[model samples]
Target: MRISACCFKFLAIIFWICPTAIAVAQSNDAQRHVIVISIDGFASYLVDDPKVPLPTIRRLAREGCVVEGGMTVSDPSVTWPNHTTLVTGMKPGRHGVLANGVLVRGGIGVPVKIDSHRDHSDLVRVPTVADVAHAAGLRTAEVNWPCTRNSKSFDDQFPDVPNALDYTTPRLRQELVKKKLLRDETHASFRNSSIVGLDYVWTEAACHLIRERKPHLMLIHLLNNDATHHKRGAQSQAGYTANAYADMCVSRIIDAIDDAGIREHSTIILVADHGFTVTPKAIRPNVLLREAGLLTVENGQLTQAQVHVVPEGGIGLVYCTNPLKASEQAAEFKKLLTGQEGVADVLLPDRFDEVGFPHPRDYRQVPDAVLVAKDGYAVSGTVTGETLVTTFEEARTSYGSHGFLAKLPKMKAMCILSGAGIRPGTQLQDVHNTAIAPTIATLLGLKYPDADGKPLLNALRTSADAE
Candidate 1:
């Protein structure tokens, strides 16, 4: 039977549009975007704490999966290393970022320092989730994300470093300057800006990227809360204010996604590098080292040293510059470090692997031993000071600090995954920050087989079905 003219025309139109519509739908599905917001010192406990006014974070937690106990950060719970773990799904040992900065070995007679002015390639040994996604033709952005300086993987990069303005992607920096989101383009202006002001600037940068580019994978980091906590201690009134501001920043990001018309298609993961611990005492292990003749200081300068302890918040990395001497006086060093005030225990190099750190024998950045600070104590790098231990009041004032053993409950980081393919109100017992990257990789329809973490299958729609 011959079709009527009107029906024929209608059928023709349907046939012609069908393929294009199908392709559009497929493209939309493939265009899933992920926004990861890291509140630097957001403790898991604070998510439920009635005192910390984080309505936005709490709402997200209510809508998404919340790690019950808390997410365990990498060993020596610190910012850069844990942030790297969140994106790489690997610990410090594998990722090759042992500290907040690159740990430089100063050899036998020199003191070591963590050089923060380093490039991404100079620190990270493994590919991040952003790198993997970008390699697979997905657009990526990073705003104030650590260890991402000069990362070619990101389509837009605004790094978190001393001279952050100098390293930002040229186009993005110009755009930001033109918009006055960044008032001045100079690194000095950025450095002089207050922590709270910089936090707002960083959030504005992230919001701009979301509205303008809608990157497939975007990582945003806000730092005011961490700085505030470091100054006034966690749960302090000042910390509450900073945290509230960070929550507002998160709200702004969500708004930007909605404005970009990709709210429904986007996934937001709220995380933290590590939790904070209020320390009243500061332990100066270097003083003990000097007294023990393991270290030497002259003319108020550390001109020479056998073993130098670099304090990293609640933990101290004891570097034995002379490996042979370290072996010879291992027992003596242990005796001196062990049972000291504010000293919890000394972790020898042999146990480094057990705690997800590279052994000193293999990695020069690895310390000969790790001095674990006890609760209410923080390690300090004061060799010239007469006292081996002192109260926080004497130094400045009692403040909050992190970089403790990952096993400590106080060192647990925060984790909240929401939107897109996530199951609302889902909860996991205790998660590791390492698992975050693989989960993000799965959400982006990519495989990160080499990652040490497994995706949170129970919290994801497609993966949960597979389970």
Candidate 2:
């Protein structure tokens, strides 16, 4: 009787452990893994350069689909709007991000903080890819992704925000505490002075989250390169170093995923918000238009002009009140701007709109005239010596700027897709920014509503088989 009882107990233990192990293995296989990595300020040149030691990225390109020239919609090409477009798959106008800084009503003295959170509701009109993924029963996570703060999209998010001004002063910790923005216990963990390029820290936090709570879909945005370009310019050694550092961070995350034993089952997509350019001279087209009587100022505010130019610092957008007047203004602005110390080319709004950007509903909000500067020329709003000198000259130390027309050779972003369900060694050209979300949805078998981006069927094995 005793021997029979022991035998029964042994059998029951085996029954319990065996099913648990098998269930875990099955769960790993049944679920799909997706990781979207945004390397801020990444231009196509990095991957194209053999000398750059981006081994993981190189492997992805060689093994996965590579969109050699991923195009951006339009300019200021600044971070917030560009990043918003990537996940939302909508143009700036549709999504309403508009610029890094939106003009406040009542001319509020300070610029509204435009970090990954929509402090004002209903600003972001569309659903993010993560939103679609979650609705389909997939888990989601984001790290340092812009405009993610207080976002309703992600299941788990570590939104990026500008380091508070007090962060630089002695009262940093106290201010963070008083505002209830961070806990005192977190002070030691987040005590870095230069928060801009803290890719390693961001990745560390992400890795911990991945291990502690395995998310099916994850989005990570690394900004070392962007910061380096903003401070050192795009072509400088600092920018190169920043790129290499970002690549290293990417490698680390890949290793983390591998260690978690999800390498083969996971798909990794690497992309950039926009490319960068270096500007040497700063041009203020509004001042010139003001002088030309094409623009007028009343009560310290700018009013209607035949051609209105808004300085994005590096590139200027021109809005024409009269479409007929555009040609005339273009001719005159061309004569007035070209080769005049800092000017590059004057682009008409009609030609500018051809990049597939819809016209702004509020014409008063967009520039009637647009200006492209030479590699070193930047635009400004300050007046000095007849020419409006926004900053005497564009900052020389920074190596990066973007927001020029996508047609420019230097303005192309990069895209790499690799993983279990993806077709290997596929090279796609002419992929638009809008197609990213749909592609992600197709991979996970999720329903993405109102997505502007179409899935490239050729890039996915499952998609091809389904077709």
Candidate 3:
């Protein structure tokens, strides 16, 4: 969720420097290395121009297959939900990661704290590609990937470093302050939530494992760009500078592979969890509900409520604590919100089934009502704001936002593949995020028919077929 910024700040260290390298032992195994580096908010525009240069990622797009048509990601398009989609090969509804945070089951008359506490595995209901790969005896590793913090499937995991329990802050800070690259760097704009230092943290971990342990399947999540794009629209000068940093991080890992003597034998897949858009307007659904008298606030707290909303970026989950009355409540919402400015779509729980969501639902997280915003607007949870409209002048400085349904024109995510089992210099069309896992599973020599995604074989050279 938005936790990536605030949560990582506490573990702040300079990110400009690269970690010292340890002596690497040569690998004896014949297995291929699949290195996945996810740039959190990367989009196709970053590499579309042939004349413009994006050194590291551009090579990836040219040498590997670029999804020219754009890849459609999971619904709600938040980080965890979409990242979960990649490993599990399922959509949000089927995967059970309905939103960034789960809705509390019986906590209706209470102020909704949707994002406060969460565990990676708490929301996932199925086996991941890594789990299947691990079961097949292939070595797997994960670094800083969300929804994977607790997974036992990886042979080596730095699932959530810096912010998670594993990172010892003082020692890390000292090591970072000593590094040449990061020692001089400063994040003056905390508005974007600096991953400047943490980027090096994950990169070093992944690189070290690549040189030494050599896991067959490695997932490295690098996310500084996500924040910059969040506060600064993709077209902003700030976003470009941030993307350059993220690109350099990728180069480090790529260099690590070459140093491991496995460059030719490795496949480097670059992707993003989702795309972003600029929204200058805000829709405060909770404010509207409060004004409607459905939500009651007292003593600067939520004392009682009939209708409540958990605002995601461009989408919001409207919850009714009583399961029985959910339908009745949703019908009323359609009338109140549908024609309202900036409101595009409002859905009832029963319609969840049609969109690959679980409706007749299970557990505490299902939304009784769902809200989607028109382009240039975002759904905010700020209950104190004006009921219907609020101009977000803050974004005027560096404007961008995401979390609408993925099918919308601007929400397309990134997918680029190169190296082993992949054909070079190709362009792909109609790629879906769901297709990634099964194809990767096939490459890892593993099977996951249970996954909703199919292998995207068009991007593959004959080498993939031989594998």
User: What are the models' TM-scores?
Assistant: 0.92, 0.74, 0.85
Off by over 4 Å in 1: 1-29, 393-398, 463-467
Model 1 earns a TM-score of 0.92
User: lDDT scores for all predictions?
Assistant: 0.83, 0.62, 0.72
Give per-residue CA lDDT, model 2, range 35-87, as digits (tens): 88989888876777655667778888888899865654445566766777777
- Higher-scoring candidate on TM-score, 1 or 3: 1
Candidate 2: residue 242 Cα off by (Å): 1.3
Worst 10 residues of 1 by lDDT: 17-26
* Model 3 lDDT, residue 189, Cα: 25
Candidate 1 root-mean-square deviation in Å: 11.9
Give the true-structure RMSD of model 3: 8.5
Regions of model 3 farther than 4 Å from truth:
1-28, 49-53, 167-193, 299-303, 393-398, 463-467
In model 1, pairs of residues that clash are: none
Model 3 agreement with the true structure over 175-245: per-residue lDDT tens digits: 43365323422323211334777777668767877887788889888888888898778767888887888
Off by over 4 Å in 2: 1-30, 69-76, 105-117, 120-122, 163-192, 195-197, 286-310, 317-352, 355-357, 362-369, 384-399, 463-467
Compared with the true structure, model 3 gives a TM-score of: 0.85
Q: Compute the lDDT of residue 197 as modeled in candidate 2.
A: 35
RMSD of each: 11.9, 13.9, 8.5
